[model samples]
Target chain A: MSYLTLSITLIFVIIPLILSKTFKLGLERDTIIAAVRSIIQLLAVGYVLQFVFNAENAVYIVLMLLLMIGAATQNARKKGASIKGITWKLIVTFLFIEILTQSILLGLDITPPTAQYVIPISGMVIGNSMVLGILFLNRFTAEMETRQNQTELILSLGGTPKQAVHTQLITSIKASTIPTIESQKTIGLVQLPGMMSGQIIAGADPVQAVLFQLLILFLLLTTAVTTSIMLGYLSYPTLFNQRMQFLRESLIRE
Target chain B: MTKAAIEFKDVDYTANGIHILKRITGFFPKGKITTLVGPSGAGKSSLFKLCNGLQTANSGQIYINNKLIEQYAPTVLRRTVGIALQEATMINGSVEKNLALPLTLKGEKLHKELAIELLKVVGLKESYMSRNTQELSGGQRQKLSIARTLVNKPQVLLLDEITSYLTVYPSRTSKN
Candidate 1:
């Protein structure tokens, strides 16, 4: 696509700006800022990706993946800052998801070992993990607060720390993963996914786009479940102390 | 005289810059009913919490069976001392499940006969075992809460405003 077509997309931005102003939804500023940020960020990433693709160096690919993981960890840590070592916990979860997905894609000869394939797929894996981490943390903390009495009752009954928080941990994990599972259930029917639609729009064959999308669908199912369960396990232990007392501090929202 | 199941010395507790418990020195003797009479905002619930090791005293030592409360393993201390708070909170399940939670935590299955027995002990009929806890009235829920605390046969029982709901707890005395 030419700069002309890219410029024409501003009309899409303009429509939201007009609608926001007319409805007095007070989202005009946010809409404009979002549009501006997307344009700048995507353009900058486009150039960076182009450079990395040409360099064809394994080091650059690793750096890009590290960069994505770092950003994801930083963003996800905010929601779980009260959790001990949450920064590393998020990094470990994201890294695990990235390595797990890439290894499968590579080991099976599913995708060529190229910067193009690795970087974009890593971005999706890390990005989804970050969102799942935030969802799990949010729900897990809320569950703890609402169920505080139940937890204490269990603890007062000789229940271990694990037993005290088991309900919250499992509830949060299932709650976070349900969205990903449900979304995939209606994928082709309710919506053409962004990656698949983008591939088709960029002139890839429909069949190839669908095949790639299916690969992503499966990878993300693994990503969603692992991210939630892994983070839940890592985080629950931190909510108790050596004496098996609930740390109450963990329930204090950041 | 009965032996004190729980004792507190110079216990001070503060929350949000407010001193709730200040230098409290007392003991709840075993094999006896100890009722702490106080109006709202008194430290009655906080005292119960401290006994169970659910919360520590800001500046005092607690003892259970003459051993420092902190020295005991948390699970062990909790198992020894069962407390039923005024605000009854039930797990999302049938009455039997809530009653058997202590046993479940111990990785032991609660027998159907015992579940019914405990239910009956708390003034609840055997039929109440299969009833959903969410369907219970406030009084029934409180009964279940107290019944659950008895599941482990905790040596020490601390009840907060229990009589406000029902005239039960004969078992705590009966067990002696």
Candidate 2:
């Protein structure tokens, strides 16, 4: 697309901005700022990706992967800041998802071992993991708050810390993954996925676009379930102390 | 003098800059019924929490069976001193499952007879065993919770407003 056509896309942003002003939604500043940020960030990433794709250096790939993990970790950490070492937990989860998905993709030759393939796929996997992390942490922490009495009752009945929060942890994990699972159920029928549509619009074969989207859908399913479970296991132990007492203060949201 | 099953020494608990409990010292003797009678926000519940290691005291010592509360593993201490609060929180399951919770935790078999007997002792019926905790009345749930605590057979029972919802107090608990 030419710069003029791309600038025309600003009409979409303008529509929202106009509607917000008309309704007095007070979202004008936020709407404008978000649009500006997305444009700048995406364009910068486009250039960076172009450079990395051209260089095709293994070090550049590693660096780009690190940058994605770092960004995802930074974004996802806010939801679980109360969790001890949440920053590292998020980084590890993102890195693990990237590595796991990439390993299978490259090892099986499912996708060529190229920056073009790895970078975008890593972005999707890590991005999905980050979102799952946020959803799980948000739900998990909320469960801890709502079910505090239930947890304590279990604790008071000779139950270990793991047993105390077992229900809450499991409930949170299940609750957070429901959206991903439910969305997957209606993937092609309910709505055409953006990636597949974009691929098809780029003149890729329809069947090939679908196959690639299916690959991402499977990757996301794995991402959704594994992210929550890993974070749940990693976060729960820290919510207690050595004596198996629930660390109430650590759960106190700042 | 009777042996103290649970004891507190100069226990202090403050929350949000308000001294909920300050330098509190007391004991509940073994094989004896102890009632903590206090108005709302009297920190009576807090005292029970400290006893079971649910809430750590800011500055004080708690003892379970004469050993420092810190010395006993929290699960061990709690199993030894089971507490049932006024608002009995029940797991989403059958009464039998709720009653068998402690056993489930310990990987111990929960005999059907044992669960039934505990339910009976708590003034609940055998039919209630299969009933969903959600369908139970406030009083029934309280009884189920008490039964759950009793399943593990704690040496000391901490009953917190345990009879508020009960139509008939399970007097047998005190008798035992």
State each candidate's clash count. 0, 0
lDDT per residue as tens, model 1, A31-84 = 989988998999999999999999999999999999999888888887554688
Regions more than 4 Å wrong, model 1? A79-82, B167-176
Clashing pairs for predicted structure model 2, backbone only: none
The fraction of reference A/B contacts recovered in model 2 reads 0.82
Local accuracy of candidate 2 as per-residue lDDT tens digits, B36-81: 8889999988888888778888998888888888888778888888
Docking class of 1: medium
Fnat per candidate? 0.86, 0.82
Q: Residues B24-65, candidate 1, lDDT per residue (tens digit)?
A: 988888777777999898989989988888887789888888
Candidate 1 has an fnat equal to 0.86
